[model samples]
Target chain A: MADPAYRAAGEGALRIEPLGELAAIFDRRSQQTHLVTQPMPEILAALAAGPCDATTLAARLADSFDLDGEGDAAAILAERLDELAAMGLVEPV
Target chain B: MSTIRTLVDLLAGRRDAAALAPREWDGVIAVARAEALLATLAHRLSGAALPQPVAQLLGDARAAAAVATAQAMWEAEMARRALGPAGVHFVLLKGAAYAAADLPCAPGRQIGDLDILVARDALPAAEAALLAAGWEWVKEDAYDDAYYRDHMHELPPLIHKLRDRMIDVHHTIIPPTARPNPDAASMLDRAIMLPNGYRVLHPFDRMIHCAAHLFADGDLAGGLRNLWDFHCLTRDFQARGDCDSGTPDGALGYDEWLGDMGYRAKLWGLGPAVRRALHLSAALFGDEADYRRLSLGDRLFRARLLARDDWGRETRPLLRLAFYIRSHWLRMPPLMLARHLWTKWRKGRGAAR
Candidate 1:
């Protein structure tokens, strides 16, 4: 199967503010604020730059932060993208 | 750079931090803070190489503004949720709208209060919804409350009991009696809806509303910030070619928009206020002829706006009072003004006792 391409739901509509370990994202589209920790913001930032599939996103994430080698990074990124999509933060492009 | 000139230049996006002396930073910051433009100043000066202390001060201000803006967004959401069930879709106004829409004038802007507009008929339902959701009338005096309902454009300001944030729910840009009774329905119909389902005034309506509010409604105490809003919004619209486009069907052109909003006479005062504050007029009013014709009112507004001393104290108290009287005069007829001032004076004396 082709890798699923993912994009942020409201690209320009989200305003992100980092608060220590957590980040606050205000979606102007939904008018709802979501607080997320770690790789979620990193993931969103990546998608914000441009749309990318899970394999490409995992490679992008690996370039920035240390990832555990025990698990497949592509699988981990795909799971994270699923969570983000459910939260209305991202969608399949 | 001269401190006032530097401040104006910075706001106009013509960066020249190299020429500023260390001693002048304190005065410039003081003036900007007093005018509630510190956040805007911080926003403009961001990323430009500056003295360490100046950069740090602006950084801190910008951080604080970001937090406030987030809180404002949350508050707006709460308002929408509370009012939406009652079929009330409120129109966000001023700073809140700017921030919500992510307009150019929004970054680093400080919102003092949340202002919204609803159809006059929906006001009662809107107020009830807010009150039921913990918003309380900020004014306790019966006469003041009555005055707001009977004569003003908005309800007495309300405060969230738990959040302690104030919200002004207005029905029209100006009081019906004060201006030519602008077509509130037309404005509401033409509002631009944001992705969040909230709406803001159309760009043209927004500009005229700011002009009217600054020049016709109040005593110009915070006129500088308001005029900057006028300048930025108008310029943005012009740059986008929105102003140059032919008038939308059933909508007024720029000149007619001003007149319909009851800013025709006040624009005379506002024109000079903008020119004096920013030292630029061509971009704002299109031509110098319109501004030149309004020089007399411009002088009055300019004196009032620029009267503050180094410490931000009004240097020309009499001129300020004259402007204050002028604002009241513009708001009501002579007889009503006399009665209103008398009542306010009596209330002040009673409170002193």
Candidate 2:
């Protein structure tokens, strides 16, 4: 089987409010306001573009933002994807 | 003026933050926090002139309340989703209801638990649905659970295992054993369904429920915040000429509205409580047009409602104890109250030991 793909929740379900350096995501499903810093919001925004596997998502992030530690970037991103999944913000596709 | 009074005055818009010493401001802020009315005061006095520190505190209060509102609404949503498909009808009650309808009392209002009123017959299904949705019993003691089931208006409180949020599923607004029994069936009959699939009580019923919660069911602890909710809700009605969805055409006065043969017959056996609530509101918020001379009992009630010292500590211990007993008295018969307290004391001792 190919690598598992994850998708961020649709626009209507999650409301993103910028809080200075961080962002507050009011998830309507969980009724939780998640205060997330950089890379998390950026990852969610990237996922919002479309569902993708970890490697593809890492490349998408790399194309625009200059990511730290380019060699293990996908590995770092897969961990973050797991975190978002646990938060119910992202789901396996 | 007393700090509690000053706080209420500020909250009610009868007084502004004009010419206040920093120490006095500190006292007022303390009292407001004690009453859980800080965010409300912040919202009410948002545009008024204020000290820089006080303004910053109020701004923080507003932010905290926003988070609270979101949590409370989310809890309500979860409850609805849990109970909806089971064909159980529940109208949101208290602060959750206000938040759902986005009423005047919604903004900056501190919410505790999700209170939803279901029909007496829907109790079993509602409880089962909630349990299946990961809600466990909050009351473990057999006696308290039995008391809740046998005498109280609601189920033994349920706390979700995952969310750690509590929900009170009520078949009526007040306890069945209480003297004043507001018609839950009729109130539910008059409930309006919002676009979001949540239901709210009619405007008048909402005020009546608030008044009952303050006087009949509770000991007037944190009564100031409850009274402020009553004030905001009533003022919103009076501002809009009392032409709520309940009264499509402009009604005459609250008296006529309550005395309406149709309403009185179907609901509102608890009209006196609403009357007292309005009289107290008028007296406190400076609505002289509707104010009445408060009876001695009413005066004591007001005193209890405003029972706060300068440092935000609760004052009037004797009065507090009396009202606490009175609340229990109102909940059940005298003998039952005594027995219940005895059992509770024994249970508490057993647990401590």
Candidate 3:
């Protein structure tokens, strides 16, 4: 038998909205708190471009971060998307 | 956030010492908030003397794992005793068994009421024994009690007089009104007894029981949750190498087993819900689906068969009339029509007093 508290989370469907701003804020939350001198401009550029899917935006932002893996970029992007979705930023659409 | 982050670590089996970068922090926070709410409920109910944080985490983890450990422990203990004296035979059903089987440490989904099965002939004795064990008969009108006992598989649920736990004693595997007498009792005859003398439903019977419960239970209300249970149980059953082939005589054959369940889920516009359940369960416990008739793509099929087939001669005319209006838009079956008319006539005559 499922307890009510556990069941509530399963039923609570996250909704999407405010297409652009939500994405930007989540994208920031996806990264670190300390704004490094160099990567900040690139993140800003990516967010400034308006609402974009993770794949394309992550690709654009890759040059700013010295990382070897696509997984790292994807992971960061996915976390941002989750944060955005939780905040009612981007939706399933 | 710390709670959720810790939960993720626990779930991932990462206990040593780990540092969370800024990026992982928010996800951790969201998970923690969700975990906290669930943990709070568990702590309140478990009655276990543990550290507050530890109890909360176990509760939270149980919630995420979708299995009720605390409730299950209580029910299993009660069930052991309830069926012990009668020797009438009983088996732990659903979450209780699933938890016992160690499917997952998390409490399985919703734990509204404990469900158990007893011998049909032993129902009276079983009811008495349950009452003796501190369960109070739910105080419903006699008509409702009679309605449930005669028509439904289980009684109106017995709440523990002391602990406030709810128990559902079932004599049949499915609702009697569904499909003009579903074969619930027949399944019990084939139930395999545990080494400890308790009975566990035969694998095939168990699987079919789940399907029947989801299909025939009225209201189509908990469609999503029921489907999720079906999906998880199916996957779990399959993964344990407890396939239809290994099941004794009446078990579902591989194709039929998967096909029937898959088809039913797809037909009911429940594909998305099923998919979500499948994905979530699989992610947690690696259960796979085998497609038989319907491809994964054709998900919008109508599952009105269960609700449609037994409209007449089953449910009360009032409820049946609602079903009739929704589907056929006209009431038929002259005998039922006559019965309704006669009942109404009697009611009116009595009212004249």
Candidate 4:
């Protein structure tokens, strides 16, 4: 099956506070605070802007960061997106 | 004079840092920070052609204020959700209310706690729901708990067990013993409900409550920020055509609808103090006649409002005490006030010992 398109739960619903490499996000909908790291923050920001599939998000992330050519960045991003979805920070649009 | 006046003018949009001396900026920033108004000052002074140093100072304060405000918003939302399941509708009050309603006064404003006003009858249920949701009463002292239940307008505050944030659930704006006894029912009837199911006081009632809170409730220690709230709420409501225009007779024209609320003297006193603090004229608040009646009181309040040193310490300690006594006097009967003061003093002395 094709990977489902993902997007942030809603605009302005998450309050993110970055402390060095780690960040805290307070989800207004679930009233949950989640501590996230590195590429997750970038991923959330991208999804918050608008919905896109893993391929599109991977492309954007590749441009923003230096990715190793040995492995598939899209699969890594898809795994991270699933974890975020489980946390209720993002949803399949 | 330069510090307070410059800060006021900056907030009123009448002046910018270009007109202030380098030495004055330090005092101005100090006073603003002391009064918990640094963020508000920062927000107001944004986009002005301020000196680079002043701009940086405001930027840092604004960023800090934004974080504090965001945390406050989260607490308020938590309170709303906790109380929602019990079918209790509560009205957000003061700083929390301003932020929740997205009022103009909210940007960069500092909120210390989450305050919500529920109907007196629903308070028990509301309290139960909050407790069930992990909020615990903050006061454990027997006397303080009794005092809150018997004399105060609100319950002893509750703190979220997990978050360590405080919430004050008030049933009314003022103590039940206060002489004015504002119509809580009327005020509640006029509350505006937001899409999120949270309610806020009507513009007129909110303004009156702010005036009463500053002039009659406590020592005027935080009067500057309270007065700013009054100014912002009035300006916001007037711009929206939500408030009645004052009369030409100059007899506190705004009091036409407010006269029956029974706090005319207190409301009248707030007019001149706010005017003096913001460098505004009597005409701005529509209480020239009332201002004339309370001119001496106005002078006293203005002095207290401006008597703070750069560090926000009272320059005139005696004057501060006098106003402190005056606030208690306004809140209760003479005998009750004396008795209450004695009890508090004794308790404090015992604690010290």
- Best prediction by lDDT: 2
lDDT tens digits, residue span B199-226, model 2: 8887678878888898888899888788
State the weakest 10-residue window (summed lDDT) of model 1 chain B: B280-289
Please report how far candidate 3 places residue B89 from its true position, in Å.
0.8
Per-prediction TM-score to the true structure, in the order listed: 0.71, 0.81, 0.47, 0.74
lDDT for B75 in candidate 2 is 83
lDDT of 4 by residue, A1-93 (tens): 477788776777889999888999887655579999988889987776689988888777777788775248887888899778656577666
In candidate 2 the C-alpha lDDT for residue A89 amounts to 82
Ranking by DockQ: 2, 4, 1, 3
TM value for model 1: 0.71
DockQ of each: 0.04, 0.21, 0.01, 0.07
Residue B94, candidate 3: Cα error in Å is: 1.9
TM-score of chain A of 2: 0.88
Candidate 1's docking class is incorrect
* lDDT of each residue in B49-131, candidate 1, tens digit only: 78899999999999988887877876787687578778897899999998877777788888878899999999999999989
The alpha-carbon lDDT assigned to residue B183 of candidate 4 equals 64
Cα miss at B202, model 1 (Å)? 0.5
Please state the error at residue B287 of candidate 4 in Å. Answer: 15
Place model 4 in a CAPRI quality band. Answer: incorrect
Tens digits of per-residue lDDT for model 3, B158-177: 88765567888887755554
lDDT of 3: 0.48
Worst 10 residues of 2 chain A by lDDT: A84-93
Question: How badly does each model clash, as a count of residue pairs?
Answer: 0, 0, 18, 0
What is candidate 3's TM-score for chain A? 0.41
Q: Estimate candidate 3's RMSD in Å.
A: 24.6
lDDT of 2 at B316: 91
